[model samples]
Target chain A: MTTTTKNNEPIITVRGLRNTFGEQVIHENLDLDVRRGEILGVVGGSGTGKSVLMRSIIGLQTPDDGEIEVLGESMIGRSEDEAKNIRRRWGILFQNGALFSTLTVAENVEVPIREYFPYIRPPVIDEIASYKIAMSGLPANAGPKYPSELSGGMRKRAGLARALALDPELLFLDEPTAGLDPIGAAAFDELIASLQKRLDLTVFLITHDLDTLITICDRVAVLADRKVIAVDTIPNLLALDHPWIQEYFNGPRGRTAALSHKEGAAA
Target chain B: MAANGAGKARSSGVLPTEFISRTTSRDMADVNGTSDDHQGESVYRVAGALTITRAATTQREIDALPDPLTIDLSEIDRMDTVGAWLVYRAVRDRGAKVVGASRDEVSLLHQVSEFDVPARVRPEESSSFTRVLTELGEWVADAGSTLLGLLGFFGATLIGFANLIRRPKRFRVNAVVQRFDVVGVRALGIIGLMSFLIGIVIAQQGSVQLEQFGAEVYTINLIGRITVRELGTLMTAIMVAGRSGSAFAAQLGTMKITEEIDAMRTIGVSPIEALVIPRMIAAVIMMPLLAFWAMLMALLGGGIFVWLSLEIPPLTYVQRLQEVTPITDLWIGLIKAPVFGFIIALAGCFQGMLVQGNSEEVGLRTTTAVVQSIFLVIVLDAVFAVFFSSIGWR
Candidate 1:
C-alpha cells in the first residue's frame, strides 16, 4: 500500500515487442509503460493487436521478440513456479467473463483464495466472497447463482468479484463494459474507479468505450500502425494530429461521451 | 458458540506452523492483554495489519476470547476489506464493541456488514433413496418424450422430402453429394478391413467346428449365409452409427448453439430441409451400397482363408458360396440397410435439434446419437429377423 514510494515507477514495461501469426504481424517493436496506480486505457482498432499486447504481457501468448517486465521482474522465459508467483499478484477479467460454468459465483470467487491461501477457512472465504460480490454491485442472491443463470451484466460483475478476490495489486480488464447499457456501463466505470482508488490497483483496461476512457482512465494509450502511437491524457491526446486518434476521440460517440462527462462533473 | 469452539480446537491443533509464522512475522498482532476496567468488561486488543493473509489466524484468535469483548484497532497500521469484514463479523456475531477504529475502518466495516445476508452455497439435496427414485422417474419421462420427439422429427423429414419432390429444383444436390463423400466414400477403408477380418474369423472357426463332422467344406455355407444375411448390414449400421451419426449430431448441435440454425430460419430457410435432408438422403443411398460392398469383401476374404488353410481352390470356394447362399439373404440385407440408415440419421438429427444452452450439450447429444441409433438398429434387426423367418425367407 506504499503508493507514494512507487508512484513514479512503471508497473509494466514493454520494449520492442513483436508478435506474428503466420504472415500477419500483429505487433512490431511495440513499446509501452503502465505507471503505478493508474488506469491506463488501451484503445485501438480491431486487429491492431490490443488483445495481443495484453496477452503478451499476461504470458498467455509468447512474443516472437521483445522484453516484458512486470513489477520490475523480467517476464520472458520464466519457469512455471516463477510465473505462478508473479501471476498471483494480478487478476484478469476476459471479455466474455469466462466464469466456470459449473461453479456458483461464490465458489468461483473462492477458487483463487482456496488455491493461494488454503489456510483460510471456508466460512471466512464465504464471507470474503459475499462482500466482494456486494462491492461489485451484485445482489446477495447472485452469490449462489451459476454463470449461465445470470445475465451478461451480472456475469461481468461476478467476474469482477472473482478478479478482486485476491485483493490483487494489479488488474487487467478486457472490454468490461462492451455490451452493457449506458447506465450500467457508467455505473461500472464508477465502480472500477472507486475500487482502483480504494485498493491502490494499477489497472490495464482494454476498452472501446469512449465514456469509460473519458470518465475513469488517468491516461489513454492509442494503438495504431502496429504499435502504440501515443500514450497521454485525453486532452493531450486530443491535441495530437494523428487522423485515427483525432477521429476516434472527436467522433460523434466520443463528443457525446465528453459532453455527458462534463455535464456529470458540473452537476 | 459450540461449533466455533470445536472449529478453533481442530484448526489450532492442525494449523501449519509456517502459516502462523508468516502471518505473525509480517503483520504481527498480539491477541493477549485482556484487562478488567471499572465497567468490569474484558478488552481484546488486536495490533498490526489485519488482511486476508492473516484472516484464518485472526478469526481463530477472536473465537477463543470470552464474550462481551471490546476490540481495540487503534494500533493497527493498515487494514483491507477482508480485514474489515473479519472485524465486522466478530462485532456482529459476538456483540463486541469497537474501542478506537479509524474512520475509514469503521466505514469499511459498515460496508462489509451491509452485504452480510445468508446465501445458500449449493442446492439442497433429498435423501439418497428419494433421489434415486426421482432420477429414475425423470429418466423414464425423458425417454418417453425422446421417442415422441424422434417420431416428430421423422415426420418433419418426410414432409421436407415431399416438398423437395414438389420443387425438385430446391433439392440440395451439392450438400447430399458432400455428405456422400463424408459418410460413404471415406468409410470404405475401415469397413472393408473390418468385414475382411470378420470373414476370416468366421471361416476359421466354422472349419474347426465342422472338422469333427468331417464336413469342413461346409465352412463356405456358414461364411456366406452369415455375412450376407446378418453381419454385413448389421456391422455396417453400427459402424455408420458411430461415425456418421455422431458427426451429424455434433455438427448440427454446434450449429444450433452458435445460432446458425436460427440464422437460417430467419432467412426463410428450413434447417430440416437444408441440413437434415441431405444427410438423410446420403445415408439412405450409401448404406445399401456399402452393405453390398461389405458382403463381397467378406466372401473374398473367406475365399482367401479357405484357399490358404484348407487347400480349397478359389473357384471351388466361389461355386460353394453361390450354391449355399440364397438370393433372399442378400435381399434381406439390402432391404434392412436403408431402414437402419433412416433410423441412424433420424436419431442423430433428432438429438442434435434437441440441443440447446451450452457447448457441453453437443458432446452429450453426440453420444446419445450413437448409442440410441445403435440400440434401435439392433432392435429393428431382431424385428426384421422375426418377420423374414415368418415369411419363410430363412
Candidate 2:
C-alpha cells in the first residue's frame, strides 16, 4: 500500500464546548482540533472531563453548547441519520474493552463489519475479522475465545481489532494501556505506534501512562482548570510553567519515562 | 497521561489513496482470465481491490462458480486478506488450483488459508423421537443432580450453623437484620394484600357453591381450612422465592463473578459464613412471621365477606371459625413456613455458587434459582399434604 501523509486538515474540531451536570460545569469555552494523520493524546487529572471530551466528539454525549465539526462538516445540528453517517466513518474503542461478553473475539470484530456490509459473505467476513485480529497483535487462537476467557491485555487487543473492523480512517481509543503491566504497556504502545504508521491512521488516544505519551504521541493536549490549557510536543509540554504540568512532568514517573525515552533515542 | 507539547506535528492523519495505487502492477498478458479445463474443472477470474470496501466485487466474481474450481488472479488489480479469503472460501475443499497470483496476494492467501482449528461445525438436527428421549433423559439427570446439590447445600448450611453455635460472636447480626428488613418487613403489604384478596375470593366462590345446599354459612369453614392449611404458607413461599430468593442468587452471583468470594477465601473468611448464613437465618426467622400475618389477613378478609354477604354477625363467624377448623390446620401451615424458607435459601445459594464466567450466567442462574425454589416449595407442600393426610391431622 502507498503511504502518503495527509496532515494539513483537522478531522475533528471542537469549539466553545460546554457541558454541565446541574451546577457542575465539566467544560466551558473549550476549543480543540484533531488533525488528520496524528496520534493525539489527551491527558487530564481525574474529573477534568477527558472522557467527556472524547464522548462529546464521538456523539455519545451531547454538549449543552458547542460547535463540533467532524470531517469538515458541522456535527452539532445534524439530524440523526446525518450524525450516524458521520459516526459510521469512525470507530471507537471504549475503556474496559466494551466487547459483547457472549460473543467470541472473532465474532466481536465481525459485528461492525456485518452491520456495515450486511451482504458480505460469512467466510469473507471471517477472513477480514481474522486479518484484523492478527493486525492487532493477538494470537491466531484468540479468535474463538470468548471475552470472559481472555486476560485483560488480550481483551484490549480484541477491542482494538473490533474498532478497526470498518477500515476506519479515524480511531478513538480510551485509556488503551491503563491496567497492563509495564512490559505489556510498552508492547501495547509499540503495537499502536506500528499500526498508526502502517495504516496512516488518525488516532485519538486517551491515556494516563507517562511512557505512552512520551514515546508515541505526535502531539499532546493537556486538560486543566475546566479546559485544555496547553497543546504541544513533548519537549515543549515539559518546559511549560504550569503547576499541574510541572508536578506531572517533573514527577518521578515522568522523569523515569523521559530518561528512558532519551536513552532509547541515544541507543 | 497524554504528552502535552507545542503545536506543529511533522504529520498527522491518513495516507492518501494515491499511495495505495502507487504499488507496481504486474501485467502478464500471456495468461488469460477464465479457462474451463477438460476434467470438468472450472476457473473464474478475480480483479479489483481486496480491501473491505472492494471485497464484495471480488466475492461476487468468484462465489458464482461451481465447486472444485480454480480462480485466476492474473488480471487482478489488488487483493487484501479479505479478498484472499473470498477466493480461498470458494476453493477450500474443491479440486481447485489458484493460478497467476502475485507474490503479496499469494502470501496473503496462504496466511489466511490455514485454520489451526476450523470453526466448530454447526449442530445437526436429530430425529424427533430420539430428540425427545434425549431431552427426557437429560431432564431426569438434571433433576437427580439438582436434588443432590440441594441436599449438600443444606448440609453445608447446617455445618455453618454449627460453627456459629461454637462462635456466636462471629455472627453478623446487622446483615441478618438487614436481610430480614428487605425480605420480611418489606414484603408485608404485598403478602397481606394477596392473602386477603384470596380469602375474599374463596369465600365469595364458596358462598355460591354452598348456597344451593343451604350451607352458605359453611363458607367460613372452607375459608379457614384452605387458607390456614395451604394458601398462607404457599403464597408466602412463592412470593419469597420471586423476591428474596432471586435477590440472593443475583447478589451471590455478582460476588462470585467479581471474585469477592475468592477474596474472602484468600483472607480466610468463608463465603458460607459471611454471605449465605445471614440470608438463611433471616429467611428462617421471617417466613413464619410473614406466613402468620398472611393467615390472619385471610381470616379478616373472609370475615369481611361473611359479614357483608351472608349477614353473619362477627361473633357468630368467629365461633364458627373456632369450631369448624381445628387448631391442627394452623399448626400444619406454620410447620411449613420455616422449611420452605430453608429450601428457598438453599436453592438460591446453590445456583449462585454454580455461577461461572459472566453476567449472562448470573442472570440465568438467578432465573433457575427462582424456578427451582418455587418448584421445590410446591413439591414439599404436596409431600406435607400427603403426610398430614396419612397421619389424619384433619
Candidate 3:
C-alpha cells in the first residue's frame, strides 16, 4: 500500500450539489472537497445533509444539481459497471456496520477481496482476510465467528476490515461510532487514526458525535442552512462568528474539540 | 362551624357566607354540604376559573391541604391552575382526603400526562408465567400464519417453474448453475445425511413387510419407487426451503433494512440485476442437482439394507432395479428438481425482498420462505403426477 500524501490534489470534488425530498431540501448548492490524505469530518445536526453529502460524493445518491468528480472521472450518469468500478476506488463504513449476516467474519472481509481479486489463491485470501481483521483491531479467532456471535464493536471492526480490503485511496464513514459507548468510541477513533496513517487513506467521516470530530478529524465541515457554513481545522472552525457555531465550539462540544486536538498534537 | 366563617375571612378577600354561596356554582360546591355524600370520606372540590399544572405541583398543594377537605369542582366553571391542580392533587396525593376528581381536572393538571401517573386503584402486576405464555402464544401464532402464507407463495412459484420449459429464458442454465452452488453445493453435506437416514428407514420398513410376504427381492422395487417418485423431490424441496429460502429472506431483509437497495438505485444499479438475478440463477441450477444427489443416496442406503437383510447380491439388486425403473424415471425426477428449486429460490428471494421490519423481519420472512417453497413444490409435484399419468407417461 502506498503511503505518499497528495495533500494539494483533491481526490473528490463536489460543486453546487443539491438534493431534495418532497418540500424538504437536504442540500442547497453545497460545495466541498476531500483532499488527498486528509481526514475531513462532516458534522451537523440531524437533517442538515451530512450523510446526504457523503452519499452524493460517493455516487451512492444522485444530486439534483451538481457535478461530482472522483479520481477525475464524472460520477453522474455512469453505467452500472462504471459506477461499480468507481466504487472500487473508495471504501465505506456503514453506520451499523452492514456486514453480511450469513457469512463468518473472515468471509465477510473476503467478499470484496474475492469479488475484485478472484485470481488470488484461497490460502492467500484467507491470510489477507485474517490480516485485515487484525488490522481493524479484532482478534484472529473472530474471523471464524458469524456476525450474530460478535459484539457490536466487533462487527464494526469486521466491517472496517472489509472496507479496507481493497486498500482504497478514499474512505467514507457514516456514524461509525453511533451506538458505541465512550470507551468503544475512543478505541475505534484510535483504530481509524492508525489506519489512516498506515494506509495514507483520505477519510470523509460523517458523525454527530462532537468528541469524534474534535479527536480525529483534520478538517471539520459544519453543514447548516443547506450548505457548509465553515470548513477548516477544528480550532479554526471553533473561531467562526456564527452563533450556533460559537455555541457548538465554545460549549461542552468545544471542550471535546480542544481535548481531541491536544491528543492528536501530543501523538 | 364558627371556623367556616373565619376560613372565608383568611382568603385573599373575606366574603360573606351568602356572597360565597351566590358566587360558587351549584355543582362547584357540595350543594347539600353533606360530608357523608359517598361511601368514602373527604370529598374535595375547587370552585373558581381553572387552569392546569404539573403532577408535582399538584402533589405539593395536596400535601398542604387539610384532611377531609371536600373539593367542589362544579363551581369551577372557568377553572385555572389553582382549581385544576388543587382538585387533582387532593385526589392523587391524599387518597381518603381527596374524592370526586374528574378526568377533566386530571387532564388539566398533570404536566407530563403522556406517562402513566396515578397508579391503578388496585395495583397488581401480572404474573411472569402468564405474561410469558401470552407473548409465546402471540409469537407462535404469528410465525404459523406467516409460514402458511409463504407456503402458498411457494406453490405459485412451482407452477411458474413448470412453465419455464416452454420459455427457456425463464430458467436459464447459467441462472440454475449459480443457484446450484448456493442451494446444492452449499447444502450437500446436510441433504446427503438427511436423505441417507430417511432411505435407511424406508428400506427397513419395506424389508419387514416384504419378508412377511416371503418376497424380499421386491423390496428393491419398493425402495426405488418410493425414493425416485416422492422422497427425492419432497425431501430436496424441504431442505432447500429450510436452507436457501431463509437465506434469501435474511439477505434481502438486511439489505432492505440498511437502505442498500436505495443506495443501489442512486448508483444506477438495478436491484433486480444486483440482487434478484444472481439468487434466481443460483436456485434454478442447484435444485435438480441436489435432487439427483439425494436420489443416489436414498438408493445406496436402501441397497445396503437389502444386501444385508435379504442376502441379495449387489448384481442381483442392480438387475432387480432395472426391472422396475428406467432412465425416463430419472428424467422425471430430474424434471421435478429444477421446478422445486425455482419455487424455493423465488419464494425465498421474493419474501426476502418484501421484508420491511428491522432484524426481526429477517427471521420472519426466512421461515415464511421455507414453508412456502416446500408447500409449492409438493403441490406442483401432484399436478405433474396427474398430468403425466393422464397422458400415459407414468
Candidate 4:
C-alpha cells in the first residue's frame, strides 16, 4: 500500500474509501494512488463499485469515510464552488458519453473552458475545441452538429474532446469503449494512450473490456468488495493469485498473455 | 381494501387472513404465494360471503346461512383506514349481511360500512348534489385563482416584454426566432388554406340567403366585415392555439421531464430565457402576420363568391371594400392577433412548465393549455369589443 513517489509526490491519493447504501455495504475499504502522467485502469464486474470509486474520487459522490486528496487539496464535504474549482483540474467522460443534446459538438467541448477558464480568449478556446475534435478522429465539420446527429463512436469522441477541453491534469474515463464497434474501440484506446502522453495526464479508466485494459493502461486496479484487491502493472496483475483477477485476465476467449506482451512491447 | 381481499379470496376460493406491506399501496391481495406477504392482505369468510380482516388470525367464528352471506367483523386485528374502507366498500354494495360481532368491530363496521347504512342509500343523489356544490365552489375558487394568476402574469409579461424591447439580451433571440418560424411560417399554409375555404363557404351561404331578396351585393359587406373583424382572426387564432400552442406545451414539457431544463440551469442558462421568452416573442410577432395573410385570403375567396353570386367583378368588390371598411378596422383586428398569440404561447408555456409524471401529463397539459387559451382568446375578444364600443370605435 506504499504510494511514495520517486521524485514528485502523487497528485491523487485515496485510502480506505467506503460507501454503503442503507444496510447493503458496497465497499468496506478501498485504497488507490494515482501519480502524474500515468494511465490507470480500474476493472471490475458489474455492481462492483468501479463507477462509485471514480465518482468518489472526482468529488461527485461522497463516500461514508475516506481521505481523498486531489492536487494536494482535501475534497470531503467541500462547498459546490470549492468542488467546482477542484473539478476544473479534472475531466470525466461518462459511461453514456453524456453530451448535451442541445449544444453543438464544438459548444459541448467549449463548456468546461467557458466555465473554468473564463479569462481565456474565445478564439483560442474555439481553436482548441476544433483541434481536440480533429484529434479524436472526428471531422472538422462535425463541430457544428449536435450530439444526436453524431454516430456512437463520434459522440464518444466528442465527449472525450469536451473532457480534454480544459487541458485537465487528471482524466476519468467511465466505459469509454462501451457500445462502440471493435475498430472504433481500438482507435479510442489509441487516442487515450496518445492523449495521456500528449497532455502528461493521470488517467483513471473504468472498464470491463480486457482489450482496453491491456492496450492503454500502464497500471491496473481491480475493484472487488468495494476494495482494491490488486493494483499493479498488467504483468504483475496477471501474476496475482486472486481467482477473479486470474479468471478475468486469462479467462475463456482470451487471445493469450503473450499477445498482449507482444503488443505492449511493440508499443 | 375489502373488495380486493374478497375478490382475491373468492376468485381463489381460499380463506386467507394475513396482512402484509407492499411496495405499492394498491388493492392487491393474494391467497397464493405470489400474493403472499408481498401483495399485502387477504380475505376470510365469517359465515359464507367473504370479509376482509387485517388480523393475522381469526378471533371468533360464527355460523350463518349462505343465503344472506353474513360476514363477521369481530376478529379483525389491525386496521389502516384504506384497508377498512376497501372492506366496507366490497361488502356494502353486495347486499350481504354484515353482523358486527364485537363492540369495536360493530363501531368499526358502522363507521366504514355503507350497506343498509340509510345515510348512503341516496349516495348518488348526495354525490351529485355534492358534486354540483363542489364544482361550484371549485369553479369559484378556480376563477379567483385564475384571475389573480392572469393579472400577475399579464403585468409580469408586459414588464418583461418592455424590458426585452429596451434590452434585447434580456431574452434569447434564437429561441424567439425558432418559435416565430415554427408558429408563424409553419402555420401560414394551413391557415391561408382554411381561411380561403371559410371565405368561400361564408360567401356561398350569404349569396344563397340574399339571392331571394335580390340583395346579393350586400353579401360583400357581410363577408368582408365578418372575415376582417372576427371570423378570420378568431378561426386562425383557435387553429394556431390547437396546433402550435399544444406543440409548444408538449415540446417544452418533454424537455422539462428529460432534465434539459435542469441542464440549462446547470450551464447557467435560464429555462425561461432559453425557452419561454423566445416562444412568447415569436408568437407575438408572428400572430399579426398570420392574421394579415388570413384576412387577404378570405377577401380573395369572398371575391370569388362576389363574382359568382352577384355578377359583381372582383375589382368592384375590392373598390367597395375600400369604401365600406376603414383601414383602422383592419389595423384593430391585426393588432389583436398578436395579443391572442401572446396569450396562447404564455398559456402553453405555463402549462408545459406545470407538467409532471409521464407522457399522459404532456397530452393532458397540451389539451388544457389549448382549451384555456381559446377560452381566454374569446373572453379577451369580448373585452376588446366592449372597450372599442365604449370608445365609439365600433
Best by TM-score: 1
Estimate the Cα RMSD of every predicted model relative to the unseen true structure.
6.9, 6.4, 23.2, 25.2
For model 1, the superposed segments whose C-alpha errors exceed 4 Å read A3-6, B1-35, B38-49, B68-78, B97-100, B204-216
Per-residue lDDT of model 2, residues B6-33, tens digit only:
2212232323221112122232222223
Q: Could you tell me every candidate's TM-score relative to the true structure?
A: 0.90, 0.83, 0.44, 0.44
lDDT by residue for model 4 (B1-394), tens: 1111211111231222222111111222122346444332233443332222211122122211232333444344333222343344445443444433333233334433321212110113346788899999999998788668766766766666676779876667666677778888989899999999999998999989988998888888888888888887888899989998998899889998898888998998767666777888788888888888998999998898778767899889998988887676786788789999989988988788777655567888899889999999999999988887687766
TM-score of chain B of 4: 0.65
Error of 4 at B326 (Å): 2.1
Weakest lDDT window of 10 consecutive positions for candidate 4 chain B: B114-123
Determine which window of 10 residues in candidate 3 chain B has minimal summed lDDT: B1-10
For candidate 3, the per-residue lDDT at B35 reads 39
**Candidate 3, which segments miss by more than 4 Å at Cα?**
A1-3, A256-267, B1-394
Better of 3 and 4 by lDDT: 4
Off by over 4 Å in 2: A1-4, A74-79, B1-54, B62-149, B211-214, B306-315
Best by DockQ: 1
Quote model 2's TM-score: 0.83
What lDDT score belongs to each candidate, Candidate 1 first? Answer: 0.86, 0.82, 0.71, 0.71
Q: Candidate 1 lDDT, tens digit per residue, B169-203?
A: 99999999999999999999999999999899999
The local lDDT score (0 to 100) that residue A29 gets in candidate 2 is 93
Ranking by lDDT: 1, 2, 4, 3
> Residue A103: error of model 1 in Å?
1.9
Which order, best to worst by DockQ? Answer: 1, 2, 3, 4
lDDT of 3: 0.71
- lDDT-best of 2 and 3: 2
Please give, for residues A180-202, the per-residue lDDT of candidate 2 as tens digits.
99999999999889767544578
